[model samples]
Target: MAKKTVEAALKVEKLKVEITKLKETKKNIDQKNKQLKKLKKKETKTKKSKVEKIEKKKTKKKKVTQLTERKTKEAKEKEKQKAKEAKEKEKQKAKEAREKEKQKAKEAREKEKQKAKEAREKAKEAKEKAERTLEEELQEQLSPEEIEGFQIEKVNMEKLTNKVCVILAEKETTGMIQSELWKKLKLSSRDGSRLALKLERMGTITREKILEKGRWTYKLIIKKTPISTESIENAPCLTCPVEQKCTLEGEVSPRTCEWIEDWVTIEIKKPKTAQ
Candidate 1:
């Protein structure tokens, strides 16, 4: 019995030791579980912060796009207004130019009308002066003895004054003398008028009369006497074929006569020449 009690006590001691080791192992497993739960919580917090950052960036970009669109619209509106104002200015300038041209044309027409009126007045004054001269010459009557004496005087004068009167009366400037002198002179072709015969003998005067359809017209010329001493001194001693070298020919020879039948007596004051 003593041997059996001893074996039982030993077995009980070994069982107590095994129970203590099992308890220590269970405590280690609980500590590992707590560490895993702490790691999962940290990972969830990091992911949530990254999503919030991406949303904030998207909102900022949208606001910037709206501001850019507003600026572009305002710029286009300003450009349109500038173009409209430029077109209106061009139209106003064209209108002013047209009005100025019209005013210039009106002034030119008025100037032309004034010039026409002045020319008409000058023509009327010229006609009235010619009529008065014709009336004065018609008042004198001629006697047969006086006619004979008058014929002699007419021939001796440098030129035939009556023939000159008839030529002057036919010109446009002296047209007023036509009605007065044209009726009194008998239109004849005979070369033997007492006035013409006396003029032929004098040798100083030349007369040519033309009769056309019962009307008589006359041309009278005067012979010019040159200074003979001056002619001889200026003459060329040598003979030349050229007419310009022969100065003596023009001075000595008879000149081509000009008809001076009715020269108007116009008295003009001589201009003073420097001494």
Candidate 2:
């Protein structure tokens, strides 16, 4: 009985040692499992950080592209505005040039018109001076005695006077210029001028100084017309049967003569003719 009890105690001691060794192995395995779990968590966190960095890089690239496009659009718009301004400036310059040319043409026309006006005035003055010189030379050619003795030959004085007076009367109060009247009467200028002076002295006409055709000249106006003797050519006084004893109150008086009365009445009733 004693030997069996000793053996049983020995067996209990062996079992206790084996249980302690198993507990030590289980503790080592739990520690290794905890380290493996920690390693897996660290790897997952590293992968998440790498993904965030890649996303950030993509977003930065997109922002850069958008900013570049906006700048390029602004530059193009500025260039277009500059081109428009340049075109407008060119248009304005052309308009100003046209206006300047038009003004220059107008001034030239005015200057030409002024020159023509001056030329016309000079011509008129020269013509007047020449006429005055001619008139003075003509007067110098005639002596005082020759002018005083001037006369038309082969013409009856009374009949010529009546003709001149009648012609002057037909011209009316405004009268005719001396040069034109001389031409119509087929007379020389010197002879017409002398006759005009004689007529003025006789109080039969008047001469008025005037300007005609840019020259100093004279106008002739009639005062009176002389009587003509042709009106009494058919009277019975010279051919009557009575002798020269007819008187205003005698027996053979002209106041009581029937033949004289009849002759006078017939002469008055005849149509007058210009002589």
Candidate 3:
């Protein structure tokens, strides 16, 4: 019985040892499984994060393209509006210019009409004056000698009158005379004398008296004619007798007469019989 009991105790000790070894092996297998599962879960999470980042990048690219396209459209529209405004402004300016040109043309036409009317009135008045002068000349009666010697012609009347007046100015008391004025004028003595007397009566000439060799002589007087300021300033001083005395200082000086007179005497003698 003692031997059997010892054997039984040995058998119980062996069983206990076997059970502890099996528990250690089982714990090591479970730890290995847990490590593998953790590794798998981490890989899956990393892949998901990478996919999300790619999607975000694609969305940003799409938004940038849309913004750029919108900006381009706005720029094109602004340019079109600017071009339209410019065209409108140019059209308005052209219209105003045309209107101004039309107004100017109308004013020019009115001014031309006024000028034509004035010219016609002047022509009519000149014609009437010429007719009256012709009638008066035809009504006058002339002597045979006068008619033979005197004939009026359309000529420079002012020049002829000046020449005759200059010649007669040397003789009468007023230092002026119209003697033979009609003969010089190539007109009838009656008509010429009438005109010359009219000029004298109008105060164009006068009479004066001078003593010559103890006798009183009658002379004609011609009033001085005024010269234009431009002529006085531009006239040459070389021919003046008092040029040396005149100076540019102080007041303006008087100038000598520009014209001088000359006279000649004539005698008529009876013809002598041949000896």
Candidate 4:
């Protein structure tokens, strides 16, 4: 209980960190906007100051205009050039500020989005963890009788394999589909699939995947034993009476058999069926 509480608290703390990061992103965006606004205000002040300077020049020129008309003309041209230069400079500064604000805003948005994604991932993990914990708790609380529908039993692999081989031999070269075969064998689909793969890997049988109803199904093809008529007829094991007890190292073995030696010599000379 204490451990679980600690884990929950840790998750909450992580979530708090994500929230703080998001807040910081927002604050940074707000600051950028404020700086942009200040730049606009500065441009407004520069325009206002230029206007005041132009008015002062106009007043000073009015008094000298009747006395020197040519001089007044040159002064007006110079004032116009200065005003144009000032406007251009103000425009450049505003453009640079706007570009900087856009870049900062993009960065802030990306940071917020990243934080949101991380929060979502954390939330998903937490939800899965809680679900697993609840499942474990439920399992601990319940008895065998309380949840008594399903039963799991161990599979006798050797028995199952022999049975499967027998079934396949009956079918011969004509293979049976996985679903039908498993149903007939009374095995679960999952277990049957595993068995089929096992047989395939061991070279006992071949399994071919087929698409039926847009879902993958298996066709199990049995690998028949390679035995020709002559080989079976010449095989000493066929005529051996103590075949059950016979081994290569035993007294009733093929090593000291004169019958088998003669049969092999004859087979080498001329091939014939025993029966």
| Every candidate's lDDT | 0.44, 0.74, 0.53, 0.71
What is the per-residue lDDT of model 3 for residues 184-255, given as tens digits with 9 covering 90 to 100? Answer: 446664555444433444455554434445543223455532233432343445355666766546232342
TM-score of each: 0.27, 0.39, 0.32, 0.30
Q: After superposition, which runs of candidate 4 have C-alpha atoms over 4 Å from their true positions?
A: 1-156, 169-174, 223-275
Instruction: Write the residue-wise lDDT of candidate 2 on 1-275 in tens digits.
Output: 67778777777777677777777777777777777777777777777777777777777877777778787888888888888888888888888888888888888988898899888888888875665633355457766666556577754545555656778899968887888877876667876787777676667888887878876888889997656667557767768777588889899988899878998899768754322
Worst 10 residues of 3 by lDDT: 259-268
lDDT, residue 205, model 4 = 86
Candidate 4 lDDT, tens digit per residue, 95-205? Answer: 999999999999999999999999999999886564443223434665544433222255545555666776887888888887888897787776566566556656778
Question: Could you tell me the lDDT of residue 49 within candidate 3?
Answer: 75
Candidate 1 local lDDT, 1-275, one digit each (tens): 77777776766666666666666666666665566666666666666666666666667666677676777767777777777777777777777777777777777777777777777776776654443321123213434444344443223232333343334434424232222323334322221244443433444335444333444434434432322342233333322234453343564322321211111111113231211
Residue 160 of model 3: what lDDT?
47
Error of 3 at 71 (Å): 2.2
Q: How would the candidate models be sorted by TM-score, starting from the highest?
A: 2, 3, 4, 1
* Best-fitting candidate, scored by TM-score: 2
lDDT for model 1: 0.44
Off by over 4 Å in 3: 1-48, 51-55, 93-275
lDDT of 4: 0.71
Cα displacement (Å) at residue 37, model 1: 7.6
Which regions of candidate 2 are displaced past 4 Å? 1-36, 95-275
